[model samples]
Target: MPNVSKCQSLYSALVSRFQSENPSLVLSDTISSWLYQSIYSIYETSGEEEAERYVREAHMV
Candidate 1:
C-alpha cells in the first residue's frame, strides 16, 4: 500500500511538472485521453482487476 501511494504521488508530481512546463496544456483533456489510453492498454495486456484499480486510483488523485 505504501508503494502504491508512492507511485500515485510520483505520477501526480510528473503530471504537475508537465503542466507547469507546458502552460498551454489542458489538464482535463490530457488526463481524459491518458485515462482512455491507459485503460485500453491495460485491458489489452493485463487483468481487469488490475486495470480497474489503476483507473480508480488515478481518479482518486
Candidate 2:
C-alpha cells in the first residue's frame, strides 16, 4: 500500500530540489497543480508500484 503522506513529502522535496537546481525555470502554480493531480490519479488507478515508478522517473529527468 502507498503511504500518501510520504509520497506527498517526497514530491515536495523533489519540487524543491528541482527549483533550487534550476533557478531560472519557474514552475507556475497551474503546472504544479496539474502535476499533483496527475500523480495522485496514477496512484489511485495504477497502484503504489506504478506511482513510485513515476516519481522515480520524474526525479531522474
Candidate 3:
C-alpha cells in the first residue's frame, strides 16, 4: 500500500488469506487495512524479521 517493497508478498498473502477466512467481511480494502495495521504493529514492536515470520506462520495456520 505504501510502496514498501518487502511488504508486497506479505500484503498479498495476508489479503488473500484473511479474505478467504472471513467471507462475511466483504471488502478487500478492509482486509488490507487490517493487514497493514497488523504488519506495522509487528514491525514496530518486533521488527521486520518477526513480521515475516508472522506471515509465514499465518500460512501454516
Ranking of all predicted structures according to lDDT, beginning with the best and ending with the worst: 2, 3, 1
RMSD list, candidates in order: 9.1, 3.0, 4.5
The model with the greatest TM-score is 2
Better of 2 and 3 by lDDT: 2
Count of clashes, each model: 0, 0, 0
| Candidate 2 or 1, higher TM-score | 2
lDDT of each: 0.55, 0.70, 0.70
- Candidate 3 lDDT: 0.70
Q: Per-residue alpha-carbon lDDT of model 1 for 1-61, expressed as tens digits?
A: 1234444444465456556667776668777567555655664566555655664555333
What is the Å distance of residue 45 in model 3 from its true position? 0.8
Against the hidden true structure, what lDDT does model 1 obtain? 0.55
The candidate that wins on lDDT is 2
**Lowest-sum lDDT 10-residue window in model 1:** 1-10
Write candidate 3's Cα lDDT for 1-61 as tens digits: 2336667667677767766877665545776687777877777777788888887677422
What is the C-alpha lDDT profile of model 2 across 1-61, one tens digit per residue?
A: 4567866865676677677778776777997887676667787888767776776667524
Position 10, candidate 1: lDDT:
46
Clashing pairs in 1: none
